[model samples]
Target chain A: MKKIIMEKEAGRFCENKDIAKKLREEIIEPTIREKEPVIIDFGNVSGATQSFIHALVSNVIREYRDQAFDNLLYKNACLEIQKIISIVYNYMQLD
Target chain B: MDEKWVNVNPAQLALTAALALKVGKENAIIQSQNIPLSARYLDRMGLYNFFSTPSPFRQYRKKEPAGRFVPISIIKNGDDQSKFVTDIIPLYHLSEKNSRILSYIVGELVRNVLEHSFSEDGAVVAAQYYKESNRISFAICDTGIGLWKSLQIWHPKTDKEALSLALTPGVTGTTLELGGTSENGGAGLFFIKSIVKISRSYFVIMSGDSEYTLLKTRPDIKNRLYSDPFKDHYAFSNSISRFNGTLVAVDLKLDSTPEFQKLLDDIGDIYDSAVKESRRKPARKPKFI
Candidate 1:
């Protein structure tokens, strides 16, 4: 039941697929292994380019698509950022 | 008095410069760096004119040079403009070097206005016709979300300091992946500064709140020293608005030849591309009108 919270950056948010990939390896991989829930924060991190958000969110959704879903969750994504991610998630068929 | 505006949202200032050269009064070719001119635009020597056309203004394409001052403007909208100057350069009988110089200057001006900008009026353009010698000037004005608005994104500093950084290559306001600033680090305008130093044509640039004018001090071209000030004054418009419209000024020499005359269409393409770059509702060049 470890709650991992990744803080948000300014409006720019984090970019580069490499960063997203690294987070996948360290955070998502371990969380799934232990079946613990993860909550990422977007309190300060305002929003990010469509491409950057796509890279990160898609990765998590695909990895835990069907089996033991809802084990990992993203919390605190700004209203704008969350809205965009939700739209993209549906577009990606992760609903 | 008989000359009427023949454009459909010309590329702002480039078309104006070409038309100025084609005016066929003094038969002089002129060029201006890519930057917005003040509201003063094209007023000079009891001659005042304004409009925005296409660049690389040519009076005659093959034989004799074009007329005195061919009015040209950019007829554009926003950033992401792909070297439309390429289409117009060949007609000028300019070497790659010459084409690069003109395009580079224009690139600097147009890119800045397009990338870091926001305007309530959509886009802005203006040119002046110098009645006496028929030197129609080119200029585009915008309420750019000024350098300060841009800097607010990352840095904290004075408007002047922000402006200085603006020309510092790669110093654009566009976010990454959105084809952010200066692919080569926003060096477009910076490179223009040096090339202009060697040009025998009139070159001036005013970005953000800073102004750089070079009329008399230019390198020799074809053993001819080119230096003529179209206008040396700051222009302000919608001073209260956040605009990024940029004005370009240049007096082109349109040699009396049909080839140069044909350039009107070439300039047309440049304007067409502006609409695409800015991602605005597609618009046509003023020429067809």
Candidate 2:
């Protein structure tokens, strides 16, 4: 398993608005370079809105279509984060 | 319209909220409007839920025939506020941001009703995002302590004042009741208001006899200016109530309309009768200053 640790040291996860643009450079691009699975640790992440998660997951899914999110699950991930993501993904598929 | 809808009930709301959290807004909506649910969740609480109390069990469920506007039956005499919204609400532009505004607003509203009013039951909340119609709506109703008794903790005289004060964003009856992060009230309403303003949505709040409404013309207002915090602006209304509680409906508009003022007046009328009826019963009267 190829593991990459991306730190949201800012503690202002909600602050990342250019999430697609930011991750395109910072995380997703780097991960695709190695072409390996990744685990996003939302352990110390302060908080986030559903839009932020959509920018993250949808961008990744855009790169690799038909990719499931739990495939990269963080077992100890915050329930709040999961709930937010679940709502977004659920609604996104509607459109 | 691609599909038909059933009029919504309270049980349908729980299923809709969960389903909207699972499927896309459209499919979840098509599944059912007056969506019924299995009683497993309600049995846990043991409270007699009037809205959810299933009538005679149907011999079989009437499955949607598929590909017609699901005829939504009007559920009368029930607090199906959120269910109405969930049945026809649209949040395409805000995406999940709208949901955040709603969830936070609701969490705060629910907690307030339960804690301050000592409401013995839980309120049912529902929402929907209709892209085709370009609107979103949500309604919430509860069977317990109405607006007056809930805010009576801080403002002892009247339910209208209690109702007005609660809508004044950041009303922290939370701290006083729950010993949470805040001591006086919950800041949730304040935050919810800001989000609603930012979304440029139509927000109407009803508690007891008072109704408060706000609309944001500029979607980019928050980014444009530094803002003041939420204040209980409706205190000016002088509206009072004798009812046991409240029902609030929020709608987001996709396009500007000339009927804006009419919308506010129409909602104002919704509670006119309820508030009047509540006051008629010679309960504990309020002495206004």
Candidate 3:
């Protein structure tokens, strides 16, 4: 299992898509490809923009589909973060 | 700028700052002499710092911008964006709940400029809290490629068309696909517009020769979120003097702000429905045979 701490990567407010893209490309994608469950921890993060959340996980959801959902875990996300993540999941899954 | 009495909002201030940067210090000048007392707000907002021409008015003691306003700032990269978001909440004297909404708007708008504007000078941002109105107003502008140019791959024939597509829920300049690519969902502006709408406030976007303004929703009327911006009450003009880059300004009424999670739920529902509806293949017309 691979753990990604959002605060360490994106600060308390995760709005930077560059950092998000980096996390996806460098960490999330590789772990998901290996079929290892990945946990994205948002413990200290206070809020996130929809764009940042979109960049971070939209592609993984697109590529992995059901497996991505089954293996990917979001821990300690605030309500705002969860809504944003859920929004991205819903839209991306529409395809 | 030499008007006898000048009154401008944060949007105008940021736009002027962007114009100053574009004209360069040598060509741009501000005449401070003969200015009205009200013009002091200009200096207070740090507009003078952008100009090479010195202020003719005597300098006043500087005050910390705690709980009132954020002066003109240039944000060039992600680090600057993060720091600005962190620092802005206290400046507005916003509560933790209120701060999230402001942070989200600022973050998405500034990030749009950084990622797409292609302006070396980055984004010029300014904001003020209107104590009388119980609202916050802010603007972000860039001298980089404007919306028309940025959306060129989509073959937008005019600036107005580009602005329309840019405001749509799922369309993006980055891709022709419905859901958009990983890095861009093209929903930033839409979400911002929705937030402003829900608050019954105004949101404006300008680029090239065109501008679109989301008019304040009437308090007496039912508020409905629309995936298509034009469906809402709005004003538009293609005749505005051409601006080479993009500028967006928002007025958020703090008092009217719904709970943060509730706002998200509302926006998320609209967004999901919009995307899902777009992807739904139109029902084939009944056979005429």
**DockQ winner:** 3
TM-score of 2: 0.41
On lDDT, the candidate that comes out on top is 3
- Name the runs in model 2 displaced over 4 angstroms: A1-95, B1-96, B174-185, B216-242, B253-289
Q: Cα deviation in Å at residue B54, candidate 2? A: 9.7
Question: Which digits, one per residue and each the tens of the lDDT, describe model 1 over residues A1-95?
Answer: 54444442212333233444556667766777677776666666534433345445555555566432477566776554555455435433412
Q: What is the per-residue lDDT of model 3 for residues B126-204, given as tens digits with 9 covering 90 to 100?
A: 9998889889998999999999889887899999999988888887888878679889988999999999999899999
For model 1, what is the alpha-carbon lDDT of residue A92? 39
Supply DockQ values for each candidate. Answer: 0.02, 0.03, 0.82
Report the C-alpha lDDT of model 1 over B1-289, residue by residue, as the tens digit: 1133222222334333333433432544333454232222232211123323232333323322122222333334422123233333344454433333344344445544554555333223333333454322334445445566765654736544554454342234544212232121233343343233333234344444454444434233222111111221223222222223233344322211112112222222322232223323357757864
lDDT of 3 at B273: 84
Number of backbone collisions per candidate? 89, 37, 0
Chain B TM-scores per candidate, in order, are: 0.42, 0.47, 0.93
Model with the higher DockQ, candidate 2 or 3: 3
User: Which consecutive 10 residues in model 1 chain B have the weakest lDDT in total?
Assistant: B223-232
Interface quality of candidate 1 as DockQ: 0.02
| Tens-digit lDDT track of model 2 for B111-142 | 44444544333454544444576665555545
User: Where is model 1 more than 4 Å wrong at Cα?
Assistant: A1-95, B1-74, B77-87, B120-140, B154-156, B174-184, B200-203, B207-209, B214-289
Q: Label model 1 with its docking quality class.
A: incorrect
